[model samples]
Target: MKKEIKKIVSYSSFLALILMSVLACSSSEDSSSEEADSDDGEEAVTELHAAFAAFNSDAVTAILSDDGTEVYIETTGYPDHTSVYWETDNALYIDEPDVSKTTQDTYIGGGQGEAASFTVDATPDLTGATVATQLNTIGIAVSGASIFNDQEGAGDLDQAAGSLDWAGAHKGPGVYHYHLEPTPITSDDDSLVGILLDGVFIYGRQCNYTGGTPTDLDASGGHTSVTQYTDGVEEYHYHIINEVYAAGNYAYQPAYVLFAGPFQGY
Candidate 1:
């Protein structure tokens, strides 16, 4: 999907910059300024990453920031795939006899629905310390739904695993989200899953560069490598961790954790 661009023009009164003479300038000044910028700068980007094209166009739209230093992602929150979470009257609704939904009365687009919007840095601040993901929406999935962490409420997700649908998702009394590897978006392959809060793209269990599971991932399941969309350039990204998360009768037994993180790209 093509992002709607937000253009910005600075009309500062101090418009002209004075150039220093070559003999008057010190080499240390340039080196010091460059180091400072690298440590804290929010780098500007010209365009959205190519992998965003894989998102469901009908339910999601990305808007580039006016200064080209951020991307605002908006989603209707309703997934394109069929799920028991949808209302019976909805065309995408489907019945899963074996699955236990969070609530029979609760459905997608009920009160708040799944609609959401958030801004992320155009370039991830990898130089800073890693930031841990919070309880709410950590990222937006390719299916146009939210991506949640491995925990539920104040505890782990094992107790609620039975309610997950065939694709490993459920409406947890709020918006619909995925807690495990969403099969509709990615199975065990090297598919693009979604972009996270820190502006890093995440993939499936396999790494596109190695054509297999990546062994050098940090605690956040991230590593610098050439993704399918990076045009052969090595860029840092996350993957759905390969370890199986066992829960009670989950349709996809030994489900993979989508991302349980102290995000490296923050």
Candidate 2:
């Protein structure tokens, strides 16, 4: 009887050990699941904060028009040569210089032209209703080389243009998009130089619209060919002027449309 009781006790001990092992594995799995959930929640919160910060900052401002059309101006280089307006249709319009003037002196050099007068409604219309509404239809364009030209250590303009990061954040959340000289557009030059926009950077030159089929415009200007992007969307982003005036140099005409998001005004 004594031997039999001992054997029974030993079996009970083995059963208890097995149960304890199973419980330990279950606890470990639950802990791992909880940790993953916590990490996902934190990431979501970070993204929300970044978006909200951009919305509330002064980098973007509303310019309500009398005709029920809303206009928002990014004053990065406001009133200066680089000043531009983002309309509801996502079209970016540069203030044309007056045409009466025979010689317009620009930072680069003197060019024969006239400054276009400011009108309520003009060609290349930039008026829009909301930020996201415009962005959804129209894209974005960037003009101006003041920042790129003034940058230090900028190599050849063409090479710099190719390396620009269009989504880089700038002061007041403005993105850099033109004049890729002085540094690669995707590099931290803008941020290091005290020009950051929510940690996002902009493209140096205007990204050409490649949504449609590729087209070739004869050598009237030069070797011109329009290639579409991977998705085959239809929109003209910029013009690549290669071999202009037989100089063998290349220059890009930057233009874009703003479509959507909190960039809209009241």
Candidate 3:
């Protein structure tokens, strides 16, 4: 009887040890799971210019650098796609008669562009709509081309349209640029085109014309909405009004101005 009692007590002790071991392992696994969950809860991160590196055109070699407070983009002021502006002797030059500004007696610039850099506030704020001071390079296109505001020389955009390439780009060999949407580098209008001087994004007409009709836009043709890079989080941005409408009625009326009024952001 004494031996049986001792054996039973030893068996109970072994079971208690097994339960403690199992509980300890379970506690350790739960702690590890909690650690992983904490790591995932950090934050959603996006960049101001980091995304532009992907759209680089062959014309410009764009380098991007960001220090927590600011972003600096240094790029060659030319496009990766073929253009009439390229030197006729260069292989990338496309001398098509159908090119927007082609005359047998005349062609646009026949040379490559020099390098230029742009800097702007990393987190620019919209104080109000402000007229662009000059025909500044208001933005940079993914094609590595500069984006001039609504004016060229002293005239409005109408005067400059004649010289643009099919991709809406033109220049004098020194500083090539785009006055309208540069579709050469982007997949479509909704794709991210580039960042403006004030660190705002510029999109083609499709962003506001999702339903084949133009959405109501503010004075600068800008509104806060979700973007591809923003990943569904909303951001303030501008859209180019470059689509021409047919004589017949359409789902959405197109915008006529190139940029439409002034920039709401600085």
Q: Pick the candidate with the highest lDDT.
A: 1
Give the 10-residue window scoring lowest on summed lDDT in candidate 3.
246-255
TM-score of 3: 0.65
lDDT of 2: 0.26
Tens digit of per-residue lDDT, candidate 2, span 169-257:
11112323333222322221111111111111122222334222224422211112232221443321222222211212222223121
Segments of candidate 3 deviating more than 4 angstroms: 1-50, 57-67, 98-112, 186-188, 208-214, 242-261
Summarize candidate 1's per-residue lDDT along 1-266 as a digit string, tens digits: 12222221122212322223442355567877888987656789889889889999998899888778999999998888999989999998999988888889889999566887889998888988999888879999989999998888888888888898877889977889998999988889999999999999999999999999999999999999999898999999999999988666786577888888989886
Q: Where does candidate 1 stray beyond 4 Å?
A: 1-40
* lDDT of every model, 2 decimals: 0.86, 0.26, 0.61
Error of 3 at 99 (Å): 4.7
Question: Looking at model 1, which ten-residue stretch has the lowest summed lDDT?
Answer: 5-14
TM-score of each: 0.85, 0.26, 0.65
lDDT tens readout by residue for model 3, 38-62: 6543222244444554557564343
